[model samples]
Target: MTEKTIFPTRLKNNDYKFTVWAPKARSVRLLAESPKLEITMNKEEFGYWSLIVSGIDAGTRYRYELDGNNSFPDPASLSQPDGVHEASEVIDIHDFEWTDDEWVNIPLDRMIQYELHTGTFSAEGTFEGVIARLDYLKNLGVNTIELLPVAQFSGFRNWGYDGVYPFAVHDGYGGAKELMKLVNTCHQKGIAVILDVVYNHFGPEGNYVSNFGDYFSGKYSTPWGEPLNFDDTNSDEVKNYFLQNALMWCRDFHIDGLRLDAVHAIYDFSAEHIMKQLAGKLDELSQQTEKPYYLIAESNLNDVRYISSHSKGGYGLNGQWSDDFHHAIHALATNETRGYYEDFGTPEQLSKAIKQAFVFDGLYSKYRKKTYGNSTKNNSGEQFVIFSQNHDQVGNRKHGERLISLSSFEMAKLVAGCMFVSPNVPMLFMGEEYGERNPFYYFVSHLDEELNRLVNEGRKEEFKTFFDDKGEAVNPASEEAFERSKLSWGIQKNPEYQSMYNYYKKLIELRKNHPVLQVPDKDKLTITENGKGFTLHRWQGDRQILAFMNFDQNDTELEVPFNQSGNMDKILDSTSTNWNGKGETSPQKIIAGETIKVAKEAILIYSN
Candidate 1:
C-alpha cells in the first residue's frame, strides 16, 4: 500500500488519479466541481475505490458521494479550500519548488528547539506571518522551531490538536504553498522544522471518516472517545490511513522531523504496534532521501521504552518528551505543590531528573496513588527532549500562566542556564526568549454548538486543583481568548527585556560552542547540594566545567572548593549586573580551599 494505492496520485501525463479505502461503501462516486462531473469510481480488492480522471488536474475541488446520497471530503484530502465541512481541493505536492537542497539539519546534541502556535504566534496567524519572525528566531540562536499541529483543524484559531483532516494543511494558514514556503525558509535560515502531529483522535466537528468504514474501535477508548481501530477487524486500511500520512509529511512536505502528539492516548494492542511501523517507514524514507527524518513522541508515560531501540523490544523512536524535567524545575522554582507538582520540589528530585530523564522510575506516585514509570535504561541525552516550558505547560493551565509570570527575572535566567548546560536537548516556548507578557491560552472554533459547550465546561472543571477559588472560566470558544494569546513582540523594545533576550542567545551560543556543554556523557554530569545551593560538574575529554547555582533568595556558598587543580577559567556568571541583576561581577579565580560564593537565584560557570 504505497502512494497511489491509497492517496491522490497524478499520472505521467499530469492527469489526476485518486484512490480511497471505503470498506463498507455500497457505491462510490468522484463528484468534482468547476465542471460538475460525477464519475463512477471502480472498486478494487480489500474495499478500495479509485478513478483516473483526465481533465481534472491539480487544484480541482472534489468530494466523494456515498451510495449517491451522503457526501464527505476525502479522508486523505491535501487542502480544504472552503473549509473542513466543505469540498477538499486537489493538490500536486511536486508542483511547489523547494530550495532545501543545501539544508542539512544539525545533530540532536546541538539542538535548541523553540515551540510556537502559528495562529497566536503572530497577528496574521498565517504561514507567511511566521516567516516575518524567522529572522528573530535565527538571531536568537534557535536551531529548531517546532510548530504545533498545522493540519486542517476546524476553524481559523486553534492550538491545533483537534485536527480532523490529517492529510490537508489548514486553508487558513495560507494552504499548502505557503506552508511549503515556510518550511523552505526555515531550512535556509539554518532552522529545522518539527511538526507536532496528533493521531490519537480528531476534533469534535467535521469528522466523517467513521461514516465510510470501521475506523474506530469499541474495545479501547481514549479521552476523546473510541480510539482508532488498530487491533480490530478491517483495521489494516485504517492503519494505512495514518501510516500514509506520516510518509506524506516526510517525503512530500520536506519536514525535517515530526513530534507525535499524545502517544499515550494512542491505544494499540497488536503484534506489530503502530509506532514501530511508523518509525520503520520513516527510517526507510530517510535512507531514500539521504536526510535524517526524526520521529519524536509525546508520551507522558515517562517510559523510556518509547524511545528505546526496536531490537530491544521497544518502539525505537528518536526521542520522547520529558515531563520530569519541567515538573522538577517548576516545583523547585515556584514552590507549587498542589497538583502533579506534589511529587516534585526537592534538590534530590531535580538531581535525579538531571542524572536520569525520569525521577519516578518504578517509584510511588502520589498523583495516581500508585507506583509509576520505569528506568530510562540509561538512554542518551539526545533521546530525551527537555524544556522549561511548552504548550501544554502553559496553555493547559486555568489562567494559561507562563513561567515569566511564575518566576523572577534572575530565576528565569538561572532556569535557562541550567537547561542549556544540561546534556539533554533543550526547547523554549515562543515569546519566552523575548519575555512576552501574553498567555498562550487554549482556544478553538468548533462548528458544533453542543460539542463546544461540553469542551469549554470540561476544560474549566479540569483546573479545579489549580485555583484556590474557581471563577467563571475564560470562554475557550471566544474569539477574544484566541486574540489575547498572540505573542507580544513589543517587549523586545524594552531594555530589560532585551537583556533577557540576549542572555538566552548567549546561553545558546555557549551550548553550541562550549566543549563542556557539548559533552553527551550523562554519567560524567554530577549534581550535589548543601542547604540552598548546588554544584554541577561536567567533563568531556580534556575539557571540564563546574557550575555553582544558588536557589535561595539570599546569597549561598558552595561547600566544596572549585579550584580544580588551578586550571579553572571563568565561563558564565549570571550574577553580573550586565544581566539586570544587583550582584557584582565574578572573581577571576578561587584558591584550592576557598569556597565559591554564588549570588542568590543565579548560576556561575567555570571551565578548565
Candidate 2:
C-alpha cells in the first residue's frame, strides 16, 4: 500500500496520531519538553497503548515517559535532534521543499557507486558539507552514492553501524531535516542514495528493544552479540519490528535503496527467510510508489542464490558485495595474506576473478577448512559489486592504510584500470579518486569505561593473532580516531590529486560510453596472459577492444596476434611515452605476429 492509504494522506494541519505496540506499561505519556504537552494512552484488545496528540507539529521535541518515569525515544520518531539518550522529535516528511522530480533511478547494472561516511567524507562532517560537493560527484560520473548507516547512535562520533533507533536520523551529522535536504539535493543532481543498514545486532548503550518483548533469542549467537529472534514463538512481532524499520526508511524517509549488512549472520530457519520477506516487501513497495527500488546484500557466504530473483527461485536481491573479488584484488595489490587471504593469492586467482565473480567458487577453502561459495558463472557481472577498497577493508585494517599507501602510483593506476574496465559494478571508496592519504581507522565511543577498555584490548588481541608485531593500538573510543578519518577537502586542489581525479573521471566516462563494458554476456569477457602482462578482451557485438596490462617492473615485449585487428587506434593509455621512446601516441599497429614493447605497470586500451 502507498502512503495515501495509511495514516492521513495529506497530513493536514501538522497534527499526528502517535501509536506504539507497548503492552506491559501501566501508563504511557507523550513528553515533548518544549511546547510541553501530555498524552494519555487508550489500551486496545492486544494491550497496545496509543494516543493521538492534536496540534503536534514537526520539529517538536518529544518522547514517552512510561508510568511517569523511565523516559525513552519514541519508537516511531522521525528525528532524534538530541542524542539517543534524549527525547525524540516529530518530523513532517512533506514539509521539506524537495527539488528533484526529473531524476530517474540509476539501474543497478549501470551503477558506478561511490561509498562515503558522512562524518568523514568532508571536513565539516555534516550533510550540508556534502551538498557543496555534488558537482564533484557528477563530474566524476558516479550515478549512485552509498552512505554508511545514518541512524542515531549513542555518542557524537561513530561508524553508525551500532545504531539503536532505526527510525531516527543521526544528530551528529545534521538532524532529520538536513538529511532530507541532502537526499533532495543529491536527487536534484541526478544521483541516487543507497543506505547501508545493520539489522543483526544493536549498540550497547541505548538499545531498548528487549524492553518491549522477546526480541532476541539465546538459541543463537552472532560475533557481535545475541542473535535476533526471527524463528522463535514471538518471531512474528520480532520480524515486524525490523520489517517496519526497513519500510520506514523507504516509505517515510524516501530512501532509494538499502545495502543489507552481513546477511550470512542473520540466522533464520523460518519457512520464509527474513531476506525473502524483505525482498518481497520491497518489490511491493516499489510497485506502489512507481519508483525503482533495489536491495544489495553484504554476504561472505558467496552464495549467488542471495541475488537471484524470486521468480527464478532465488532471494531476488539486485546485487551483492563480492568479497572474493575484493580479497583477490587487495591481496595482489598489497600482498597481505593473513586470515582468509591464506587461501587465495595468485595471478591465476586474480584472472579467475576476472571471469568469475569469486575465486573460490565451490572450491575447498583452507582457511574455512571446508568447501565454500556457489558458482557465479551464469550470473551477470552486474550482480557483483567489486572494489579495491571499502570502509571495512580499510578501517578494519591495522592502520587503515589505503591502496595509495600500500602500493606505488603505477599499481594504483593499474588497480583503477582493472576495477573500471571489469564487467562488475565498480565502487570507489571516498578519497580513493584523488589518492587522499587519510587513514579510515575504525572508531567507536562507549558510555561504559570497562566496555571501552575491552574494545581496545580486543582490537589489539585480534591484530596480535594475525600479525605478531604490537604497536600503539588505535583506541576507537577516543576522539583522535574520528578526527583522523575525516577527509581533507583541500586535497582536490593539489596537482597530483587533480591528475588522478581526472584519470578517474575519464575511466568512468569511458565505462559509461562503452557498450563492451556493460555487456553482461559472460562469453564476451576473455583474459589471456601474454608475456609478463595480461590481455583482456570484451566483445561489443561484432567489434572488440583489447586491454593490455604490463605488471612487471621492466618494460617487456608483448606478442600481439596482429591478425585480430584491421586498423588499430589507441583508445586509452596509462604511460608517459608511446611504443617508441620519442613522443606521445594513441594506438600503434604491428605485423600479424609481431611483438611490441609494453611499458612497465602500464595499461593500454586498443580499439579495432
Candidate 3:
C-alpha cells in the first residue's frame, strides 16, 4: 500500500545528481560556492535537465543557472536553510529518531482539538517551544493539536497561509529537526497532530515554480493570486507537487492529519480532482503504515461530497471545518448579525446547525442572492469539526477580538459547553481555555513596499463599510497591529482567567467521562427550545444526561417533556457561584416534573 518511492535509494556517491525541468532554457547548469564547480545538465523531454557532479553533497549551497542569466532555487528543494533569495540546502529525511509505535487511533468523535500557530503559541515561536507546554495541553484534555501551516514563507513573521515552499519547514521554527521533534513529542503524549496546509495558491513572493513551467492557470483566479493550474496542460506535475507535499508531512514528519485550507477556492475542472487524488494517496499510506492518517478540508461549499467516502462517489475526506456550525453559534453568542451572519443568529438556525451540522442546506442566501450549500443531513456529526471561534473568525475581524473579549465570561462558558457537548469534534483556539484577551490579527513581513501598501489599503477599504470607525481605521499591515496580536500568557496566572480555564477543562473531562457525550449519535441527541432557554438531551445505555442553557439575561424556567422517575443528580454547571467561590463542595439536586430554573447565561448538565 506504500506509495512507490520517488527516490528509490539514498545517493551514496559524493556527487550530487541534480534534476529539474527547464524547457524554456537552451541549457541549465548547477553552480555551487565554497567548493566552487559547474556541471552541465543533459536536456530531456518536457524541459527536464539533470547533472551529477563529484564532491557535491547535502548542505552544499547550489543554484540552477538558466540560459546563463536567470538563477533560481530547486523546485523540490530538500531544505531552504537560507532564505529563498539564497541558494538551496539539501538534507536527508532518513536522519531522525522516532517513537510512538504503540499509539492507537483516537476516533474523530473523541477528539478535543486545539488549534495553534507555532510562531505564536509560545514566546520563542518555535516547535521546541510548543514541546515545553505538552503537560498544559494534556491537563486541558486536548487530544489533537492542529497547527497552522509551518511551510517556508518570505520572512520569519507570517500567518503561514501564504507559504511558498510546501516541503521546507520555516527556519524560524527550528526547521526540519524541530518539526520532527514536535510531531514525535505530541505522539508520545497520545496527542494527534494535524497540519493546516494551503494548497489553493502560493504566496506572491519567493515562488519559483512558475519559472519551471506554467504552474498557474490564467483560466481561473483567487483573491490572493492566480489559481493553481489543476485543469491546464502539464498539470500532472503541478498537482503532484502538492500531493507529494501532503504525503511528505505524514510520512516524513509523522503528522497524523492535514486540514486543507480554503478548498472552496481550489478550482479544478479535471475529471479527477486534486483533492480526490490526495485522499486516495492518503488512504494507501494509512494502510501501509497501519496507522490512521486523516484529512480535514476547510470548505464552505457544504457540498457533502467533501466528506463522503470515495466508494460512495465523493471526495473521501475524513471531515471539514464546519463553518456553518461556527456561523450559527457565533452569531447567536455575539449577537452580531451582519455579513454572512445574516443567515444565522436565530435559535432555529443555531439549533439546526447543532443537530444537523448545517444551517443552509440549499437554502437561499440573501447576501449572495442565490441558493447556497447542500444538505449535510446524511453526514454524521463526526464529519464536522465545530467551533465557537477560530483563527479566521477572530483575525479577520477589524479588531481581531476573541470570544471572551466580545462577550461576558458567562457567555464564553456557555458557548464552550454547547460546542464541547455537541455531536461534533470540538476545536479550541490557542489560549482559549484562559480567555486570552490578546488578538490573533493577520500579520506578514513582505519586503515589497507596493504589495504591503496594497494589502494595508485593501484591508481598510473592506472594513470601512461594515465595522465601526475604530475597527475600520487601524492599519492591518502596521507593526503595532501585529505586536498587539501576540498572546498574553501572563493571563494564565490571573484568577479570573484561571477560573475560565478550569471551566473548559472540567467540560472536556465531562465530555470524555460521559459515553453519550463522547460518541456523537446524531439520532439520540435532541434540542428543544423553551423561549429564552434550551434543553439538550442525550441517552447512553440506560441513563440520560440533560443539558440546559439560558441565553436570556434573566432567570428562566424550562418545563421538562420527558417522564422523570429516577433520582437525578446535578453533574456539571458553568455558574461560578455554584462551587462556593472556588474549591468548595456544593450539594447536588434532583427534580421531578417541576419548573427548572436556569441561571442567566449559564449551562448545567444533570444525570441520574
Candidate 4:
C-alpha cells in the first residue's frame, strides 16, 4: 500500500473514479441514481473494480450493482445523506475552507480530555452544536475534546458503537462538511479533538461490507459477533481498508487522536499484529505532517503491551484507558460490590491504582474467577488515561446515575481531586464537572423491530447480575431514554452545581501550574493507606505536595506520614465552607509529626 488513500470515491477535474473491492462478484456495474446511467466497471488486479466517468462531480448519488442484480451503498461511502440504506453521496473532502493552517497539536501527556456525545452535548445534536460551546470547554480548562464516534450509524440516536460506514460522517450530525468545520473551529480555539472509533465489529443493522468481500471471520467471536478478518485468508485488503480509514481521519478530517473502543475484542494471531502496523503507519504520518498524532485504546484486559514500546515486545500505542483506576474510585465511593466492582472497594486498591497504575496486576479477580492483568510498574503514568466515571460506567447501569446521585456531592469532589492529583492523565465525562443529575441511559434507534427487541432484551440480561429482581432496567429503544440523556445546561446556575464546577476548575488549574503534579513519574510518589483513608506524597527535588483523603463517615485524626523541614501550607481543602462542605476542619498549617483531624469524605492538599 502507498501513502495515498484509495478508499473513498476520487473526484478530480470533473471526473469521478469509482472503485470497489468485490472479489467474489462475477461482474460489477456502477449505478448512478441521479444521471440514470448504467456502466460496467473493468476488473482490475486484486479483485478491484473501477470505472472513470466524466462530466460528473461531487453530490452525485451512486451505488454498486453486484452481479448485475442486487445493489448496495458503497462500502467506503464518505457521506450518507439519505441514511445508511440509501445511495452513497459523492463528497469532495477537500471542498471545505479551513483556517487551522497554524494550529499545533497538543502532546498526549499534557492533554485534559473531555468526552461528550454529539447528540446529547447540545440541543441541535450536531457538529455545529458542539462548536457553539467551544468557549465553554476552553473555560473549563480542557485542552482536548473527545467526541463519541460520528461514523454513520442506523439512525439519529446511537452510542456510536453501531456505526456501519467507517468512512462516512453521520448525516444527522451535519454530515462531512460540518465535521470539518467542527475540527477547524476547535483548532482555532486552541482545543484538540479526539474521535472515538469502533472497529471490533460492524453494527448488526445496515451492515453491507460483508457482501463485498470476506470482511469477517468465524474463527474468532466477539460480544457483538464475529471479529474482523485480520489474519484470515485475503485479509490484507481488509486490514488496509480500516488502516486507510484511520489515516483519512488524520489526513483529511484533521483528527488529533483516536480512542479505539474495546480493542481486547480485536482477535489477531499474526507475526505482526494489525495494531503494531497501525502504530507504525501513524508514526510515519506524524513525521510527514510534522504533528504528533496519538492512538489510545480502550481495553479491560489490563495488559501493558498496548502502551509498551515496540522493542519491548509490545504493540507501542500512545495510551490506553485505565479501568482499574475508575473501578477503584467508583467501588470505594458507591460501595456497590456487584459485577466487576466486586474486585474493588478498598483504600488499598485505590492506593495501588494510584501508585502502580493497575490494581489487578497478576492478581486473582473474584469477579473473573481467575488471575488477570500484567504489571504496569515499568510504564509511565502518561500511558494511562484515568477517570472517575465514563459513559460505560454510568450509562450501563439500571438507572444510569451520576456520581453525585449515587453517592454525595462531597464524594464527587473527593473523587475529582483524587483523579486530578494522580500520576495519570485525567478525563471528564460531559456534565460531570457541574454534577449534572440527568441520567445518560443507553439508547438507540434501529429500523429493524427484531433487532431493537433483541437490544432491549440483551441490555436487561447483561445487568441482571448487578441488580436484584426488584430493579427494572430502562428500555434502550424508547425515545424517552434518548431525550432524557441530553445535558441540562440550565442546571449550572444552581448554587450547588456551580460550586462543583468551580471546584473542578480550581483542581485543573493547580494541576497545570504545579510541576510535581504535571510530571507523571510514579517513582517519585509514595502512597500510605490508613484505616479509613490514605495519604499521597509526590515530590520533585525540593518541591513537594501531600494529599490527605478521608473516606470514613466521621472525622478522624491521622499523623502526617512524611517529614517536613518547616510548616507545610494548606493549598486546597475540599471541606472548605466555600465548596458547600459541612465546615473547614483541617488546620491551616501542618507540622512534621502532628496528627490532624480530616473531615469525612473530603480531600485536603498541602505543599511546601
Which candidate should be chosen as best, given lDDT against the real structure? 4
Assess each prediction's global lDDT (C-alpha) against the native. 0.84, 0.77, 0.80, 0.88
**Model 4, 1-608: lDDT tens per residue?**
32335554556565777888888898999888667779999997777888888766678888899997899999999989988899998878987888998987987778899999999999999999999999988988999999999999997789999999999999999998999999999999999999999878999888998888999988989888779998988777788888988998998999999999999998888888889988998899989989988999999899999889999999989999999999998989888888899999998999999998899989999999999999987788899999998999889888888888988898899999999989889999999999999999999999997889999999888877887554787789898899899999875569887888888889998887888887877889988888768889998888999999887755455544546666788889998877878778678888887776677788999998
lDDT: worst 10-residue window of model 4: 1-10
lDDT of 1 by residue, 435-519 (tens): 7768778898887777779988888778787763756667898897798898877754787788788888888888888887875
TM-score of 3: 0.94
496 in model 4: Cα distance from truth in Å? 0.9
- Cα RMSD, each candidate: 1.6, 3.0, 2.7, 1.5
Candidate 1 Cα outliers beyond 4 Å, as residue runs: 1-5, 468-470, 554-560
How displaced is residue 149 in candidate 3, in Å? 0.8
TM-score of each: 0.97, 0.93, 0.94, 0.98
Query: What would the per-residue lDDT of candidate 2 be over residues 1-608, giving only the tens digit for each residue?
Result: 11211121124554576766565577777677557887776765443566666766666787777777777777656666767677777766667776666665788888889999998888788998889888899988988899999988887778888888877778888877788888888888889889999888777777876665566888888877777888886676667767877887776667889999989889888978888888888889988888878899999899988898777778888889988878887777677788878877676777788788888788999899999988887688888889989999899887878888987777777778888778888999999988888899888887767877887888887787665564676788888899989887574468667767777887888888877876545568888765447778888777777787766655454544544656556676766432212233334654345455566666777776
Ranking by TM-score: 4, 1, 3, 2
Per-residue error at 196 for model 2, in Å? Answer: 0.8
Model 3 ranges with Cα > 4 A deviation: 1-17, 44-47, 52-54, 471-473, 554-565, 578-587
User: Could you give the candidate ranking by lDDT, starting with the highest?
Assistant: 4, 1, 3, 2
